[model samples]
Target: MSNSSPTAARLSTLDRGLPVWIGLAMILGLGIGRLMPGLGDVLESFTIGGISVPIAAGLLLMMYPVLAKVRYDRLDTVTRDRKLLIASLALNWLVGPAFMFALAWLFLPDHPEFRTGLIIIGLARCIAMVVIWNDLALGDREATAVLVALNSLFQVVAFAGLGWFYLDLLPTWLGLSATGLDVSPAAIALNVLVFLGVPLAAGYLTRRVGERRRGRDWYENRFLPRIGPFALYGLLFTVVILTALQGEAITSQPLDVARIAIPLLAYFSLMWAGSFVLGHALGLNYPRTTALAFTAAGNNFELAIAVSIATFGVSSGQALAGVVGPLIEVPVLVGLVYVSLWARRFFTDSSTATSVAVPVTSKDSS
Candidate 1:
């Protein structure tokens, strides 16, 4: 008889050693990029509304399974959590960008292009991969879905204005060199629609139909476990494609990439820790706190990269900086998932810990 623990038994081999899989995927991507430099161009040639179709496909695939796992009927519970809602808004919009602005200038003041790029990244709050991180850490899936949707809406409405504020106005005020970011609301909206909206709709529809057809128990127990692993597969695929596309850029400019990475590393750690502590103080339970921290810490790197390339050209230092965002972010956030889980022990197990945080099962075997 097998002596494997129940938790280990529940998790697939892919999920059990996710970090190893992700690392290998990254290495494979770099190899592909270095060996066949033109592959990125070939894949990117087929783009819709200025977004790459292949990348979009991976993102949709990555998002759909996680979103489908969300108990949408329970979102009203998340929405009513005023502490979580207000904290998420404040941390994402007000604190996140400002902190990145400070870090960019502090770390790479001499490299104006990289500095601007870092600030651009900061201005773009996360709308995509935070879902994966939140789920892995056993966060409140319903709350995460709601928060991601909210950030998507905010990104479309406020991205350009914030870009101007951080990239232009604030820099000018600080006696720093300023550059204009020529982004339109329509373009931003298109990104949100494709990256977030499509997958969201698909996931929602999937859950609704599956539940209707097979009942909630079968939909959650049978359907969900089957699809859950695909989310990680999509993540691995996206990582490979992304790193492959940026392989030459990363390998060629090791020093510059390192320089760009330092502040990013600092930024991710700071935002996540700060948000986690704040959530605890706000009396949020572990699941909601995990959701809050990840959503706060993650960035919309896709939008940042697009904006950088559009504004400064693909070969420019700003674009390199943007490329480095996800490269640094992926590994760091993966590590933070462990940190969040370990920290979960600190929270009181009682539902009376706060009015905002509803009771959630901490374990997600799927």
Candidate 2:
């Protein structure tokens, strides 16, 4: 008989077949978009203060359940782990943008609009969706939450300045023709407040109220289980809507999409692998290491898309570059989730073993 406990083997069918579900969702979305070309336009018309309402809802729904599962009270530990915090900041703010700028120029030097879009993508560090990736990889939840919140704060303050630097200053310095990106701090702040603020508040309040009323056991064991599956549902929903919206752009411009995708694939792979190695070298546990890797690898494609549309018209090549970001990111990052799980064996630490061996709730994830 297998040594696996009944509980360990009790993964929900959805959990077991996550890749299939995600693949089907993508196919379904592409089909919907292809069959109904007007659907994307109709969805685009519904917005709240320059933010897409449906996308915002799906993101919020995707995030809240994962955030609620975070042990907010334990965030102090993550904060105090200066190794993890400092590494995350350096990787996200410093190395990440610079690397993407290099890749954009190196890969798409002939395509100015696409290069600019990719640079913008790099500047907009991840403040959303990374939570889902982290949780799925069994990353440290408290660390992911704290790191994501930190990124949100930095995104609001640094995004515009960084945009100017990467788009204009650095190019001019290198004697290349500079592209000026006039992005507003307020718009980025609003995007952050809406996409990150709403779900963060809801999740915090959920844990606070649930634990206060029902105790931690009931909160985690009963309440979270009921809500845990919603995170994936929300993820699937967001994927469908987003893919549908970008279906036309994606299908029509296969060559351009391929060009954009090459750099993104490189960026994601390099950043994640580099961060994971750094985390291991720094002696971080597997969970924290995974958290660092995912946060560093992910990008705020939403902000990139919005800024591209606002700066260059919606039909511009820049917008298409922005549109192609998630098309590459979703599948690539999902693959990295499995890579992370497999790499856990190399960690060879007690915590890694325990996390892997434990029978956790749906919320505990991969």
Candidate 3:
């Protein structure tokens, strides 16, 4: 037998510890804000077009890697598995957002800013980290890749409309205060263009140019591995900066953070469970089910945070809630990976049983 150590496996897992890094970044950012409050203000002051330039850059960096990895060519083939696509889209756009809206109201009825922040998160589907979670759970990576690509594109159009409807129009109908809500579709579209559209176009261009120059093999094997870590670095840096900016609020109202966290925790769990059950009931196989579950469960907190800061001020409770979103999401999704893996056997076994129960044809005996 070949000598193979478990240490390698452990090390490999450690490399994927994004949550730990994000947590550390938050702590460091909080400390920096406490110690050098002036510096945080200066960083926040570097704004252009109603958005922080530094945070915008970080968001772009965080998004580009994942977007570049998408095989746009596979989009045509996604329709071949229409069930998977339909299920994912339904949960992501309809069930997932509506469920979170209810939870936010139920859990945070008094905190409209926090509720709005959560609503923004709900409107934006997962684009980046769902891929990681899908990989960890041995889900269908190709399906997820296609889904994410579609989601990224769809978000540019859908997010703004959904944000207006849920955050502004619906709230007004329900007699909720729509104060400070920038429900202007034009403004929302501009934010989407800045935060998502630019990065998406850049990622596509990078992939195309890199493939043309260095060849697909080199682009995938060499170029991708080298640049992929930048996304994580960007994410951590954004978390730190955002946390630092809001450190005073976080410090003063710890319970407020916990209150914001409650609905988020519920949203993640409910999304995952609902998607999994729906996929299983629809007769989706294990891999497809896992893909749906993970995708629906994960939120594009980066986009949500950027939009929150742009629409609501950086120091607004909305932005603070956006920051808290990933803090709850990263660890919860990581834990769900393990749960998904354990649940995989049950799905597989059910599929096996179904196959066995099918009758054999008499022509086979002849």
Candidate 4:
């Protein structure tokens, strides 16, 4: 039940083309902001209950297509691949966030806003791109699909609580000044509901309704193919809006953007290694191991950027940090894909050894 075949084609398109589009988005956004500052201001002023309505809408659109592709029915695999599930959860929630916190502190001690942004990035796990990464690496695509469903559900429940703990309570406990926004859990949860919950329900319903009307094959192949590009379009549109709003800040302190990127680069490298090592230690095969590694390493920048702008305002350094994330992440992950292909050879050799070492039975000798 892996949607790998369809996902593969779409991912190939995205892999080849998305970075160029994203770079153009940034440039155009910056141009718009510089050339038409009044327009950016007008858009930023359109908020609903303190959240930027345009960005929120873009976030929902970005998430919906990806979420709709998730095969919730395949979630039964959790009972079968329990170890993979447990390891993924632990790495994503526990180890990954903690690692990011340390790196942000170490690298950006004087830049609290940047540090806060990095922490937010760390807290939001990748729900969309992991499937692409897993498929490219020849990982267990079905397992990746299952984890994606679980991650989408988990983010709704845990993102707010964990954000409060890491960005607020934990900082206070350590006598460090908490630089995150002073929003309550209710506010955070509301944002999650608006951004994640609505799209998730819509996606699930879309899949169900489409299948009932058009049949499963048509739904998976035809309906999904038509809708899949929406997510990327939404992403590019959001990037343009974000950079337009933050163009002044980004232009004024260009080096700050590079400074913000350092911790992110370190976080990606460290988490990938940690997950890869842990997966092998747990005796998972290459496919499952790569799935776990990519899932752990990928961060949901769409959610992070939306929440940052909502919580801290579009012009804030925190929002700028969120914008810088995908700019760095897309290229880095593309390179990791090649690294994973090379690493596959080790797993192949391991499998060969196991087959050759099998004990012979007396019947074989006779």
The TM-scores of all predictions, comma-separated, are: 0.93, 0.93, 0.78, 0.77
In model 3, the worst 10-residue window by lDDT is 356-365
User: Which candidate would rank higher by TM-score, 1 or 3?
Assistant: 1
Instruction: Give per-residue CA lDDT, model 2, range 298-325, as digits (tens).
Output: 9988888889888997678888788788
Cα lDDT over the full model 1: 0.84
Better of 1 and 3 by lDDT: 1
Report lDDT per candidate: 0.84, 0.84, 0.72, 0.72
lDDT of 4 by residue, 180-299 (tens): 554455554565567657877897899799888999778666676566666667767777877787676677778998899888888887788888888888888876788889999998
Worst 10 residues of 1 by lDDT: 353-362
RMSD to truth, every model = 3.5, 2.7, 8.6, 9.0
Deviation of model 3 at 112, angstroms: 3.0
- lDDT (10s digit) by residue, model 1, range 32-117: 98888787677667777778777777888888888887778888989999999999999999999999999999999899999989
For residues 19-54, what per-residue lDDT tens digits would candidate 3 score against the true structure? 577679888988887777676568867876556788
Error of 3 at 263 (Å): 0.9
